[model samples]
Target: MSALWDLPDYDDHEVVHFVRDHASGLSAIIALHSTHLGPAAGGTRFWHYADKTNAVKDVLRLSRGMSYKNAMAGLPMGGGKAVILADEDRTKTPAMLAAFGDAVERLGGRYVTAEDVGISVADMQAVAERTSFVSGLPAEGDNAGGDPGPFTAFGIFLGIQAAAKFKLGRDSMDGVHVAIQGTGSVGGRLARLLAKDGAKLTLADIDADGANDLASELGAEIVSTDEIMQVECDVFSPNALGGVLDDASIAALRSPIVAGGANNQLARPEHGKLLAQREILYAPDYVINAGGIISVASEYFAKTENREVDVAEVRERIAEIPGRLVSIWEEAASSGRTSAEIADARAQELIGRG
Candidate 1:
């Protein structure tokens, strides 16, 4: 493994922590990318990384993305992320969660954690047992706690609409062919939304059964995971992991528009330029995937203020995603830059002002 300080993207971050709890076998990394806006707040991703180096790199990138995402979404929170390097299937335990919670508590509010990939609200609840720096709990009374999947999908749906409008010269998704490369929580809900709008759907996932089930429900054609990216479609939505838009896939992609709920869709920054060169309208992933963070921010605000959560306000904020996308699209078109570059510049300006 490369030296932590020598890793790419390490210089800009404020702090990075590696935690180990021998008794509980909990090993994790938490990265705080920025605190110019406020205390860092992002999700706790639990994945069985091949090694500690991969976990560290993933947290660093994800934390940085959260910073930009929060800035672009007009939120007060800064960016941070946590990743536990253990198999969620067999290694997760209550003791392990409490130990992870203790590690978060040590940060003393510098970083707040929520649920991400391989993590659930129940897991957040377990983390909360040891520290108050947690969000995404199950709803009770007026508290808004639950999965952010649907909200995220809603944002992607809005982003897809904006892309459709820009590329197809129409505001509706009617009869538009969209190839979704993951049918998990976010993708499944997104497919339902698109289906309601009369879009033709092509679905694929690593989990064949889940993908097939969703496809049957939505009348979407099921494609193998490998073929989904190269499929003929008007839009290609990636709801799976990152690095799917790397050199090979970008060269093979046939879609006119690329938008999705996944974070870090572009394998490298230059891939954004490549997509632009190919005449693909690319929605910045951080900008499009801000829906979950918006909901989490609202819940955090309500908790801090000791007030009832405002569901309407959350919906209103999410509804603005399309307009934001349109503005970014216009700016990219006028400036002759990729949308990712434009969004990153805008986010940096916001961070600087903070």
Candidate 2:
């Protein structure tokens, strides 16, 4: 176990390096935290962690977040995350995925993995080749898999609307200028949906071409990723990674609403209060981004049980975010607590029960 994982509250740990000699690559590092709720479940993030320590920190924090996310989202699962560090020259191949599949099988469903950053549907398919534990598989019913990005974006979008209504008394997204801080798969899909609802978009990404392409396709303007924080827009959607809104970024924020699909969007809990004071309607990241988990949860349990996930049911359930956000905002105002605290309380209560 890493020294950092020894933090007083966290109670469990597991790490595996799925190496493929044929592909000369490492496939994944799976982490599970089961005691918090039930089995650990989270997406597979494919990126280069600076070291084993950093990777451990990410997987630990992420798995813990998944526990809270599921509890808050009203699901029966706990939290877990898988990471695949790519060497580019040494790894990333079908054989590597097969190796990852073996690693997942070894867990015996104590942790479940799905699609996330740096991973694709094909990768999940490869993982699926090794374990029945994998979700986001082919259309077992009305649910099909290419990626869960759009569905996640929809949940965030609805949560944003909820934030807007709670903070601004607005019911529609019409004419809302939204500055998106990362126009990748999830962010791009979110931009399109918001655009469809008549929200103007100012988009940014490290991939200039990808950003520009999405901007052009959506009739939106492109900005440098850094500029997104200071854009004079109604909503600032940090659709990238965690810690984007730290003391530095929070001090520079110009929007009244901050919402998106990024996990752990706030550098720390106090940032939520900074938003509250700035009158910025900050949607809790885990609460808003629960769509992918909800989808995959259905796949994990429903598909195997041969039960159908009614599309309307899932969509309707997603729409509930706005109402929940509205209530949380009101509660925060009345109690003088950060909305995230309120949210964390809810998650804690749920997890505490089990």
The 10-residue segment with the lowest total lDDT in model 2: 15-24
RMSD of each: 1.4, 2.6
Cα error of candidate 1 at position 75, Å:
0.7
| lDDT tens digits by residue: candidate 1, 1-354 | 777778886747889988989999898899999988888999998898866677887998899999999999999999999998886464798999999999999999999888899899889999999999887877676456577787889899999998999889977899999999888889999999999999999999999999999999989899999899999999999999987898889889999999999988888899999999999999999999899988888888778778877666787899899899999999998989889888998988888832
Per-residue lDDT over 1-354 for candidate 2, one digit per residue giving the tens place of the 0 to 100 score: 535547533445544333334453564567675546666789888887656566666776787788888887777888888887776453477777887888788778788888989888888998898887787766644653446776788898888777767667778989888899888888988998899998889999999999998899899999997688998888889898887888888888888888888988877678888877777777788888988788788667776677667555677767777777777778888998888888888876787743
Please give the lDDT score at residue 340 for candidate 1. 89
Q: Which window of ten consecutive residues has the lowest lDDT sum in model 1?
A: 137-146
The TM-score that candidate 2 achieves is: 0.92
| Runs with alpha carbons beyond 4 Å of true place in candidate 2 | 6-24, 88-90, 144-146
Best by lDDT: 1
| Model 1 TM-score (2 dp) | 0.97
Residue 232's lDDT in candidate 2: 88
